[model samples]
Target: MIKYFVMGLRGFFLLAAKIWSFVCYCFKRQARTVIQHQTVRYEVIQLSPLSKHRLSMLKRKTLVLDLDETLIHSHHDGVLKPTVKPGTPPDFVLKVNIDRHPVRFFVHKRPHVDYFLEIVSQWYDLVVFTASMEIYGAAVADKLDNNKGILRRRYYRQHCHLAEGSYTKDLCDICSDLSSIFILDNSPVAYRNYQDNAIPIRSWFSDPTDTALLCLLPMLDALRFCNDVRSVLSRNLHLHRT
Candidate 1:
């Protein structure tokens, strides 16, 4: 009788395990279908439009912007295209000492970056955080600044923590209030440790027609009024992909 009871209990457990696996498999299938549909149809879509009623002014939040791919893309050997206007600064070269050898890299600033920086500086503290080496990042930042003094701070690769062989930008290192701080990065991996506080952007390579920065103005404007940035970001963050 005891053996029969034990066998009955084992069968029940096996059935439960099978049921659980089937449920998980179905959920995964549905999630994949949803993600694939979003990728193709809504890749450049905007977040839910912010209501005018929610635009209550609050304490200024911290906006951390990534350098490479987010604001600019640089390469060691890419040829610089001729500037549309003679005085316009399209691309510049930075010489840095790496491994005791001087290396020169070409940097191309994203279109409308200057205007974006000027506008955002009024709403939040602007921080340029890059995974690139400080030697190169600082020079590029300096050129962008051009004594306008818009960028509030700068952080480099040494500031990032390595997690599972990928560089993660831990927001806790900089801000005590994670709710009020938001990071805009082109690489999702950089913000995997803090997805809710991140707004992943598409990586830019030298596309003259790119208008991503301009499109973000409305979202950024809405975010300035929120008491906690995560509340707004959580709704919008999932829409973007690296």
Candidate 2:
């Protein structure tokens, strides 16, 4: 009887420890998120009043999207899956020339990615901004595009600004009009300087049930009609902090 009681006591302590550990982990995550939020300066650009003619003539809004974790996840070293689907092989087998040696990379597209790009293209000028080598980024973009003609421009790692051990994407470098340009990326650091014009997304990996891309369609569609994209983004910026 005493041994059984002791075992129960031990089990309770083990469960308690686990619960405490989980709480600490959650607190740490929240703390990190808070820090990221505080880092954002919320510097909304003061735009010159647009003339009626210029507003009417403004083309489509510009959407700069990140690669890798945002649209797809890739690894240079991995056991090639027999097929992503029953009869389909991996999406694309790309060879990148690195240091005079060829390195192969396997890419997997995010769920609903094709539909996302197709629909978004109609509403915005799509640009791929990735902190990865051009060789790799171009191949992945090609595979995803497949002549669909959605992507208007591609910016690679060379275009990114490296600071404090992380790459920061400067929207100003791409275009001077902050009101019409926005970025979608998984990394908060990438858009730290442009928080007012950033839409932070969760990193996508191998989740077949992931609906992030599809879920964004409604919001993206609405943003296309906004006079200034940053005005719409700034209101929900808190929800995206790391």
On the 0 to 100 scale, the lDDT of residue 33 in model 1 is 56
lDDT of 1: 0.78
Q: Give one digit per residue, the lDDT tens place, for model 1 in 1-242.
A: 99999999999999999999999999998886565334111132333545433543355688999998889877763346632333444478788888898787767888778777877887788888888889888898898888988774898999999888988888888898988898999888888877889887888977666778878887887677777887878876556552
lDDT of 2 by residue, 50-131 (tens): 6434545765789999998899887674447623443434567788888898888877788678778877887688899999
Give the best candidate by lDDT: 2
Which residue ranges in model 2 land beyond 4 Å of their true spot? 1-59, 78-89
The candidate that wins on TM-score is: 2
Task: Estimate the TM-score for candidate 2.
Answer: 0.72
- Looking at model 2, residue 205 earns an lDDT score of 68
